[model samples]
Target: MMNIKETIIFAPETFNLAETTRSIEVAKECSHVFHCIFMGYSKKYSYLIEESNFTFIHLEPHLSDKQITQIMNVDQMNGIKHPFTYEHIKERVQNEKRLIKIYQPVSIVIGTTLSMFISSRVCNTPLVYIKPLAYTRPYFEEGYLPSPFTSMNLLAATIKKLFISIALRITYKPKSFTKVAKEENVSLPKYTIDALDADYNLITTTPEISQVYNLPDHYQYIGPVYAKLDVPIPKFFDHLPTDQPIIYFAMGSSGSPNIIVKLLHILSELKVTVVCPMKRMIKSQLHKLSFNENIILCDFLPAHKISKFIDLSIIHGGEGTVQTACLTGKPFLGFGLQQEQRVNINQCVRFGNALSFRKKDFTKARMEQLINHALSTRTIKEKALEIQQVLKDINGPENAAKFLIKHFTVT
Candidate 1:
């Protein structure tokens, strides 16, 4: 008699690159013991799932391009605006519940899929969330706040926290989701942090750098789960000279194109060679501006593959990008576009592996100054390399898979 494999549904918000890729990487590890099925509403990144040879189920109420853009902005914490409509949420919930009933999987692992939070509960299926440590409750309650750079006194900081607490209550509990959850007899989340809660919240950062006091057992601190994109080496890399220092500018999916353009012009004046992977985001800008012989622009570069050749990385501190920098042993200069990114960057700054600046201070001169410092400084490079040695040994994907197996064993 042949043994049947257990099913595990991996639902990721397909509109974002990091979220989609992270799910794929983790699902790859889980494939040995389970039949992994990828599901999402956006076709924007369906190709990534198909390329990995995973079975993808297209969900209904698909997200439009404009909605995806709106989501990106909301993710960046620009405002409280969202794209979830009553009809859309209703249809999504019904579809999610139907899929859950059909699969009856061990657990549903997700990456920022808001609908899964409700449907998983309705079906009584366990939900595992893959996210950065900053989103966890202990990180906030353990007083990772009153940041070092803040000039505010204790009273001011208290007021700020109070305001944020109120905001969380209002924004985290969206009307559509709350209404849907209540209709399905699911308990509504009281605070914003509750929205991110799952049966097993896999915090994707090393414990050493997470800086959260007294972490709970339910929240596992799996080391960085970064993407190892299967992309070919850029053609320009072959012809490039090895004498000059090479700087990697990776703003990631949410980085501002205007800032990238300005930074490129400044880099043009420097003696270093720049490898920038941003053709898709700045194609029009590229046509408008004259290229510097030292600057090479490509649609994408396998960051993990090229880290050895680069001297420094400049990035908009997305969690995945920061982890990739650490995993590859590259010292970086980070400019965070939002609160979550700021937390990720600040943790690296504390480790002395990177330098960061606020948006107000992110001028051309500051960018140049930091790049020069990171390139010349031996300590930053050494620290990054040290973290690299530690991270490479963790085997985050395998560990995460094991954690799931431990909780939900296949019999």
Candidate 2:
């Protein structure tokens, strides 16, 4: 007799590479026990789901390039410019309701999908969120979050923490979100962070890096789920010599091109070889600037796979990038662009696994000093390798799947 597998809907914001990949990895782990259906508005990363042999349903109200940019701006705390209009939210809710009726999912899983927070509750479906440790309530209460502004003194830090505490206590729900919730007869989320709440909130980082304690009963650690891109190795790696130290420089999708350009100018003069994947960000400036013989530029390289060849990494402190570096047993020098990234990098710094600097502290000499220091340091490498062993013992995706299957009742 064949036992039927219950349905589980995975809603990931496909515009963000890390979010999409994290969902895909976990879905792959859950595919055996659950019939996974991936739903999203963006088709940019649809191929990732398709390649993994999952059923992907493309939703309506597709986002434009400008709208995607605005969404990113909202995430970076720039402004309230986004595509979540009242009509759009209404339509999205309708679509989700339709999916729930048709699929009868045991649970709706999401990674940074704000719409699901409302829809899942309205539909009475269990919701599971794969989130970063930095966003958890315990992390916020710890006051480890630093201000993104240039000021790094005690007074400025204290004011920022106070402001954040106040904001978290107040009701800052979006108008469209409130309207949709009201129409559905569902209670609206009082605070902004309430959107991140779920029946099960799985933190995607290890305890050593986060160091956040006293989590709620519902929140659990699932280890780090970093990108393991399935791509062929670049041929340039063959020509590079092994005698010199190699540095992997990646300013992820959210990093600033201007900062990358400035750092490149300094790196060009160094004796170490630099393998930078910045073609997408610096396409217009590539022809104007001449590259050194030691520097190699490419469109992309799987950072997890190439960690063996590089001595150290210089990156914008993104969650996925930081986890990848730690998992691969390599030290990194992080330059965080936003508050979340700052917190991620700061956590690593606390663990003595990496060093970091702010954008305002950028200098030619400072960059050179940090790069040289990271490359020459033995303690950082040992600590990173130590964390790698810890990460290896726990498979984040598999554990997350097990937790979901055990906790939720399949209909």
Candidate 3:
């Protein structure tokens, strides 16, 4: 019931809402000028989809958790497997092929530049990659202001890069990638990183967080894209002390529930006031747990809204949450739950505005130490102010939307 000529296909390859949120903001921002048809697996973020302002196409072949676990079992890193396999890509292609028949789009939007690339190529549509992270690796060149994110010397950084490169080389079989190419009836470059080659690379981090590096002209660095909601402040927040800075805390969905519970209990005794937002299940069980009035529990309130009112944020190092914290020039304690998160939080620490901890090594004492450390120092806030101005000058959604419209305008 929509014009195929005006619609843009936005297909998120992965299931993580953290990454999907970037495209959501961009689409909502520009949905007036251009119609965006969201195409993907639905069960990933069914909660927010109903409330979101966009049309969605549920791809064929629903995947149960058990099926997802089996097909995606090989070469698990950080003890977590990626969301794709030879079989998953085949299903995605079939679904996309069906979508093209119903509504031919002007162009296709992508994140992580994975399985969808094959379909875009077949349709002869321009593909736009919207990355929530910086493509630039932290360079520890001699005499340069060492980026603490890596905590490595030039040699160490190089070695780490090589090691990771090797890991990527062996992570999947050549036949797995080639099989997708065969399905598309096209030849794809051998390397996995080649997937990044696109009509445009819309990088979504400020240059302040990324190391200065020469990139292809197609790569444009837009600042962080954050979604805003108009929700009323909870009455519980008003009861907390306005006298001093209150801690904004979120453990994220990645942590073990038991570990999360233990950590929350230990953090409850802090002398300073804290605001923690988490799942309803945890909030329901809080009656059995003990916490002072100083620590307040909340359920899925808008983090951006709550961000402005808080002095410091403690997060699980997801891109969207970290970006939200930075936009406000607020200091934070980042507890990275996985490799991707560890890298993200490491950059924040290296940027000199935040603290980073690995979930494996992060203990209650370390959490207390970092919280006190971030609050006590004015330098953290000062450093955050440095990036805050840069982010403010950069309009993430508008710039990205305009660029896409221009590219597909002539189509």
The worst-scoring run of ten residues by lDDT in candidate 3 lies at 135-144
Candidate 2 lDDT tens digits, 226-333: 667778889777778788779889887776667788888778887789999887778878778787787788876788788778888888878888888777688888
In order, what is each prediction's RMSD in angstroms? 2.3, 2.8, 4.0
Residue-level lDDT of model 1, residues 1-411, one tens digit each, is 987778899998887788888888888897887889999999878888999999999999989978887887887876667789777888999999999888889899998898899899999999999888775567766635426425478876777687556645654567888888889999856777866789888888886787675778778888888777888987777777788878888888777788788778878877789989988888767668886799888877788888767888888878889988888787898888887888899888888899987666556677678887887799988999887887778877787888887777766
lDDT of 3 by residue, 87-181 (tens): 86787777787786677777788765366677777777778888744322222221123233245678876766665555345434345556987
After superposition, the stretches of candidate 1 with alpha carbons farther than 4 Å from their true spots are 146-172
Candidate No. with top TM-score: 1
What residue pairs are clashing in model 3?
none
Off by over 4 Å in 2: 147-164, 281-290, 409-411
On TM-score, the stronger of 1 and 3 is 1
- The 0-to-1 C-alpha lDDT of every candidate, in the order given, reads 0.82, 0.81, 0.67
